[model samples]
Target: MCCNENFEERNKGEKITTTLDLTEISGMNFFDPHVHMTSRTTDDYQAMADAGIVALIEPAFWLGQPRTGIDSFIDYYSSLIGWERFRSSQFGIKHYCTIGLNSREANNEKLAEQVMEILPSFIFKEGVVGIGEIGFDDQTAAEEKYYRLQLELAKEAGLPVQIHTPHRDKKKGTQRSMDIAIEHGLDPKMIIVDHNNEETVKEVLDRGFWAAFTIYPFTKMGNERMVEVVKQYGPERIMINSAADWGISDPLAIPKTAVLMKRSGISLADIELVTYRNAISAFAQSGQIDEHDFIKIKDIDQSQKFASNSILRGGQQPRIDKNSIIIS
Candidate 1:
C-alpha cells in the first residue's frame, strides 16, 4: 500500500490528463511557509520538489470538520512530525510544523482544555517550528481565550506565532489579532499575521508585525494583487504563501506570484525578500533552520522503492519527473 493511491486509482480509469507547463519556472528554490500537505497527495509533493520547493511548514489547523477528542489532535500532530515529515523527505522536501489550538475549534471548551494540556509535550519536539495558525476565527470569546493561551505558550517557548485572521470582518479581526497578541505580551516582531489584503496590510505593517499574504485562487490575494501590495508596502518583513489546503488551491502560488512580480518590474532583491528571505527569517526564529540546507537536491533515487510502497500499483509507471517526457 503506497501512500499515494489516488494517482494509481486514476490510471485505472480511462482518462487523459494534461500537464501544466512549468519549464520557464524551474531552478528557483522556494519555501512555502504555509501548506496543508495532509489534504494534498504524494503526486503534489513530487511536483512541488520538481518545481523547486525545497522546504515547507505545515501548521496544525482545524480540519474542515471539527475534531472531537484529544487523541485526534495527538494523532494529527504526530503525523505532522512523523509520517508527513518522512513523506516530504522522500520527495526531497524538508517538512516542519507548528502545533496549537486553532481558534475555530476552541469553541469546544472540553476538547480545548484537553488539547491545551498536551500541547507543551509537542512544542519543543523535533521539527515543531512555531505556535500557530492560531487566532480569531469568528472573533468569539472562546476563540479569544485560546488565542491568548497559545500566545503565552509561544512566549514561554520563544517561538513565533502564525495567526489566522477571520475571513469575514477581516479588517477588525486582523487588527484585533495583533492587539490581542500585544496584550498577551508577545512582541509584534514575533508574530506573522497571515492572509492579509489591501485593507489590512497597512495597519499590520504600521504595528511592526510581519504581514504574510496568501496568493490563493479566486478568493484571496492573487499574484497581481500581491504585486500591488509589494508596491504599496515595500517588502521588509512581508512574506507570501499558498496556504494551499483541501480547497481549490495551488502549491506553486509562491513561485507563480514571484514570476508575476518580476514581470511587473519588481527587482530580484524585492522578490527574494518576500518569497524566500522573509519566510526563512520568520521560521529561523525557531533556531532549527540551517541556511546551508538550500543546495540543490543531489542523487534523488527516482528508481528507489519504499517498504510495501511504490508510486504505482498493478505494474503501472511512476512519474518521478511529472513535467517531462512521458514517452508512451
Candidate 2:
C-alpha cells in the first residue's frame, strides 16, 4: 500500500512479492471490468480497495481443470452472483458477473448443451450482467457453435457480450468473434472484446466494440504498453482490467497501471475513462450497474450474513470498517 512495498503474491501458486505503490492514484478509484475473484482471496479484496478499485466484473471462465457435470457449472455461476457478490459488498466493492460456457468448455458438446439449457435461469438473476468471457479459445468448430448460440442468447436477452479471444491466433479469433456477433445481428456496442493487445485494438475500436486490455506484470499485456495504447488511441471505448486469478497475476494491476499512466503524462480524465468510466459504460447496458451503488462507500457491517454466513470466523468480532473487505 506504500511506495514500492514488497507485497507478497502467488506466482503459479508459489509465494513471492511484487512491489506495488498505490501512492499516485490513491484517491482515484477504478473499475476493473474483468477479474476472476473466485480464484483470488480476501487479501486480494483488501489490497484491491487500497489500490483504488471500487467495482469489478467477474466473468465465468475456465476453472483450469475441466468440469464434468452441470452441477459444478451451476454452483460456480451461483457463487459469482451470490457469495462473491456478498463478499465484495462486505468490502464495499460492487461486483457484477457475466455467465457463459467458456470456449474450451464449449468443446464438451454434451455438457455445453446442458449448460445452454441452464443459462437463461441465471443470466437474469440479481448482479448478473450479461453473457460473457465467452468466445474462442482454440477457435474450434465446437467453440464457434456455442459462441454463436450465446450471442443469440445475449441478443434476445438484450444484454452485453464479454468476449475472450483465443491465446493463439488472436487476430483471426478476435476478428471472427466480432464477425460472428455482427452476423448474428448483435450491435457492436453490446460486445466487449477482452484480452486485446497492440495487434487487435485498432480493429476493435474502429469497428465500434469495446476493446479491453488485461494488465499483467511480466507478460501478456503489461502496464507500460497499456499506457501507449491509451496515448495513441485515447480512452473512448477502451477499458483496462486486472484479470487476476489463482496463478501468477496482479489483482491490483488496474490501479498500479493507473499510477504508471499518470506518471507517463496521461491526464486523470483519460486514465479514469480507461480504468473506470469506460468499463461501467460498456456493461451498464445491462441495467444492473448504477454509478451511485459503488461511486462512494458507506458503512459496511462484517457482522451481516448472507445465508447465515458472515465473513467473521469463530469468536471473531465483526468490524464496521466502511473501507474493509473479506472473502472465504
Question: Who wins the TM-score comparison?
Answer: 2
User: Tens digits of per-residue lDDT for model 2 on 166-214?
Assistant: 8789899999999999999999999999999999999999999999998
RMSD list, candidates in order: 6.5, 6.2
TM-score of candidate 2 to 2 decimals: 0.87
Each candidate's TM vs. the true structure? Answer: 0.86, 0.87
lDDT tens digits, residue span 30-97, model 1: 89999999989988887787788888999899778899888999999999999888777767687888
Lowest lDDT 10-residue stretch of candidate 2: 1-10
Of candidate 1, the 10-residue stretch with the lowest lDDT total is 296-305
Q: Give Cα-based local distance difference scores for all models.
A: 0.84, 0.86
Q: For each candidate, how many residue pairs have backbone atoms clashing (under 3 Å)?
A: 0, 0
Query: Model 1 clash tally?
Result: 0
